[model samples]
Structures are given as structure tokens and as C-alpha cells.
Target: MRRYGPAVLLLLTGAAVLRISLFGDLYLRYVQAGLRPYLIVSGCALVLLAVVSAIISRRPYDDGCQGHRHGPGVAWLLTLPALALLFFPPPALGSYSAEREAAARAAQGVGTFPALPKAKVLDLTLAEFGSRAIYDSGRSLKGRTVRLTGFVTRDDDGTWYVTRLLISCCAADASTSKVEIRGVEAPPTDTWVAVTGTWHPEGRLGTDEAWPAVLDAGDVRTVPEPANPYEKR
Candidate 1:
């Protein structure tokens, strides 16, 4: 059993990966959608390696008669996470993660963004609205009723924002984008919602003061969390 620890770990981990990536959108909770293929390949490889390792270990190897080695007794404990991956995959990052992120905009300087579409109400990601609100010299979000969807997060003062994580590749590298929502009762933290509102400018564009954009919410409706929780930057 001790000799099989690594093989067991690999097998459990690979099956977990395949369960998340090959069968469904569960991988979206942790990585960008474009990365699904890579994850699938990696899972398949791990499973194959585990099978090969187990087969090779079963082959007879001659050793001059002696007592058995310890065979890394403690190493078996490492399989706990692999087992967890199989049964209890972690939830996507939520209000706790959002609350810890600082309220600073990226260093993108103020500039004119291209005009928005002809639609009456624009559907925008938190990242898009936050960026436009903070740095767009044109005030692109001005006068446009927009809808944003994200889980709720709050500050110590009870100010709640529609918050979402933006990832470059995976959850480990995710950053937060949020918009302070006003004129509506605060929802419980981490409750997903669609917020329809107009931008409420807070400060001068491109300045630190204008960060973490504000929205004057006209309507707030609880919604199911989306399939892909993180926005890929």
C-alpha cells in the first residue's frame, strides 16, 4: 500500500481534473475557458502516468533478503487534497476574496474609448464598467443605463459593490473589479445579482479618487451565478 501512494494520488487527481474539465464547465470556476483543452490533456496524462506507475511497481524486483523499508509512511497523507478534489472541489472565489482586494484601478492612463453600441441599455462586465468609469476621458458610461452582473461584496462601512474576479489565466492570478451600488438595499454578501443602473461619477477621471466605480442602482435582482465566474483579461 505504501508503494502505491503516489499512484493513488495521481489517479485521484487525474480523475478529479477530468471530472471538472472533460465532463462539464466546473473548470470555469478556476481557469479561463480557453484553457479547458490544456486541462483535459493534463488530466489524461496524469491518469496514464498513474496506471503505468502502478503496473511497473507490480513487476517483481529482486532484493537480497531484508526487512521492508518505511516507504514514506507520512507521504500517504498528501492524498487528502486529491481525495478532496474528487469529492469536494472548492467553490469559486467570492466576497472574501473581493473584500481583500484593494480599491485601485489599473495604471491605464485616461483616454477616449470608442463609442458604445446603439443599444438603449448596454450589458457590460464589471471590468468594462470599472475601467470606463475610472479612466475614460470621454465618460463613456455617462447617460447610458447599463446592466452588470456579479456577486455582492462589501466594505467595513456596509457599502456593497457588484464584484467580479478578472483572471489572466487562473484563479491564483485573479484580480478584483467592482462597482459601488447605491440607491438600493444591500444584498447578503456573495449573492449573485444583476444590477441595472447608470454610472455615478465619483471623482476626476484617471485619478485614484475615481477608482472602484459607483452605480446608482435602479433595480437589483438575484440571479444564479454564471457558468464562467471570472472574466479573462
Candidate 2:
């Protein structure tokens, strides 16, 4: 068990890297900020455990450690928090996202929106789209089908929302925009997906529409996260 600790740490490090690449700053956006500190602490603990384990094994340098073997239980102490995280992750992708989405709607004004072209893709950041949608509300999106892509973020209602985080400087100043998409949809967490639909106001505050503004959507397909995930929206 001690011998495998280093291998396990390496595997976890690889997994963390993969998750960061796939989700971009998703972990920071959705998960609590405190988690970053926890991750750092856990990493240090794992590294320390590996060093101690290596010293015990002493296979490569058997000078001082003639016959020292660490107990298997030592590994468990280092693994407790990590296992807990795997078994029960923090509550993320909930009310916080909805609150931010609503806040975005409030900030949008009449001047920000532009007349969208037909049969075309709207290449705007989540924040830009959100601002425009709020500003124009029902008028701009009605009867016009547009396509947008981003990561899936969940709201408090358990209804999956299509969202993208827009950044001006970096992840620290990032903002998000969301749309409640229905019809052609499935779960696509932490994955890039393209949705096509005509805007239909859901009749919420600020906008004369319901939660979902896009309707009769077509070609909702999953794709990869772009290299520059953040856009000036």
C-alpha cells in the first residue's frame, strides 16, 4: 500500500490537470473559492506522504533505512480527504448560477442590443449575449433562430442551463450568461455544446420572456472547448 501511494498521487495529479483543461475555470466559477486552498493543502500532504514512503522503502538508497516499512494505515490518513471529495463533492452549479443569471438580466439596457442577422451564428460572449438579451428582451430574439455554444451549468431548479463564462482580463473578473434551453437537449456537463433556436421570451422581469428565451431550437450538439474559452462578452 505504501509503495502505491506515489502512483496514486501521480494519477490524481493527472486527473486534476485533465479536469482543469476540460472545464477551463469551471471549477473556480462553480466550486467554492475555498476549494483551491484545500486542493493545494491536499497536494502538499500527498507529496509529504510520498517522501516519507520513499524514505521507508529505501530500495534505491538502502544506506540508513535497512529494514523499515511503513504501516498501510499511514496511507489512509493521507487519503481520507481525497476519498471524501470523490464520494461527496461540494454543492455546486445551483442557486448561485441562477442568481448571477438574474443579475445579468437586470444590467442589460436598450442600447446594448443590435439587430441580429438571420440564419447566422451569434459569436458573442455569455455576458454580451446576456446583456443584449436583457436590453432587447423579447424583441430581438423573437422568430430569429440563432446558435450559441458553451458549457452546461445547472441552476437551483435542477433544470440544466447552457452557460458560458465571459472574461475581460482573466478568470478573476469573469462573468457568466445562461439560457434555459428546452426541446432538443440532454445532459452535457463540463462539455461544449452548440444550441440553435428561435428566441421566445419567457416573460421574466426586465425581459418579456420566460426563463428560456430560445425556442424551436435545432442542431443542439456537443463540441470541444475552444482554446480561448473566454470571450469579451
Candidate 3:
């Protein structure tokens, strides 16, 4: 076990770096709910464990193991949690969260969305589309490539949403973001999936008048959730 310590540390370090790099922006956007403190605690524990292992490895083993393995072993064990983080990860924000947090879309004052320019390709994130729909009818999102990641939250009715949560460092800071995914193969609720489709707005008046909802799916697939599931973009 000691011999494998360095390998373990290496893996954990990689995971921590990955989380920081990929989710940093998303974390900043929604750093509420006391999530940051948990990160501080966990990070300190890992640093302390790594340091202690280094110290122990330097001390000669009275048992005469022939090499310094204890230090590395401790380092490896310290990494287990972080590696698990990269795998069996937390589910992103879904329908369960939609009602809990103020709707990301609703927050935008009632107005119509901007019509997407014809023949122009605009790329948007799930939050962008959802928020736009809430603020205006759906004008901002008309006719654009929207890329979103989330667990499927479906009602017995045909309506479904593609959603993900933005976490500051942990679950507490999680903020729900989602888009209406109409007209397509609906996966099971809570299943992680990716959708590449065009936005559609329904209704012809009021805030709905400005932006109209439209739906066009180019591709849909069940994909593994990224280590950092939130959309920084």
C-alpha cells in the first residue's frame, strides 16, 4: 500500500486541478449555500495528510522494509476521496431544484426575447436559453445552436427540461439552470444527457411576443457528466 502512495497522490492532484480549471467560473457565479467551507475543510485535510506522509516516509522503518514506502502509501490513501469525486459524482441540479431556487429564467423581467438573426449561428448554454425564455418570450434564443447538459426531469406530461446546477465548490452553493427541451426522445428522469438543438418559443403576445419558442433537435445522446457539470459559459 505504501508503494502505491505516490500514484494515489498524483491521481488526486489531477482531479483537484481538473475541478478547479473546469468549474472555476461556474463556482464563482453561484457560490452560496455554505459550500465553500466544505471545500476548505476537505482541502486542508488532504494537504495535511500529504505532508504527514512525506514526513513519515523520511523516517527509517525500524521493521526494515528495505525502502521508503509508508510515505507514498499515505499519500495514495489521501487521494482516494478526490479520485472518487471524479467518478461517482453528485447529480447536477434538476427539476427537484427548479422550485427551490428562484427560477433562473423567471428572474429576468417579463419581456420578449430577441429574434436570432437569420443565417447566423449563435451558440448558447442551457442557462442562457432558459433565462432568456423567462425574461422574454424566447426571442433571444430563436434559431441558434444551444448546447446544454443536465439530468432529464420529465413530468408525466410530455414537458421536459434539460438541467444542470452550478456549484461553488460543493452542493450547498448549487444553483439550478435549465432549458425547455420539447419535441424529442425524452430520456428517463435524472439521467445525464446532452442536447444539441435549436430553440423555439411559443405564443404570439406579451413577453412571449418578443421571443417565440422553437424546437429543432440536431442530435441527442446520453453522455457522461463532466467532472464539473455546471456551465461556466
Mind giving the per-residue lDDT tens digits that candidate 2 earns over 86-197? 4443433333443464432343345535666665565545554555555663466555557777777665576665776655544555566677676765564666787777
Output the number of the lDDT-best candidate: 1
lDDT of 1 by residue, 83-197 (tens): 8888898999998887777766556888999999989889999989988998888988889999999999888898899999999989999888889999999899999999999
Clashing pairs in 1: none
Q: Pairing residues by index, what is the TM-score of model 3? A: 0.51
Model 3: how far is 204 from its true place, Å? 7.5
Clashes of each: 0, 8, 17
Residue pairs with backbone atoms closer than 3 Å in model 2 (clashes): 128-233, 201-209, 201-210, 202-209, 202-210, 203-209, 203-210, 204-209
Selected candidate, larger TM-score, 2 vs 3? 3
Top candidate on TM-score is 1
Ten-residue segment with the worst summed lDDT in candidate 2?
89-98
- Over 4 Å off in model 3, which ranges? 1-107, 110-122, 136-138, 203-214
Candidate 2: deviation at residue 19, Å? 18
TM-scores for every candidate against the unseen true structure: 0.94, 0.50, 0.51
User: Candidate 1: how many backbone clashes?
Assistant: 0
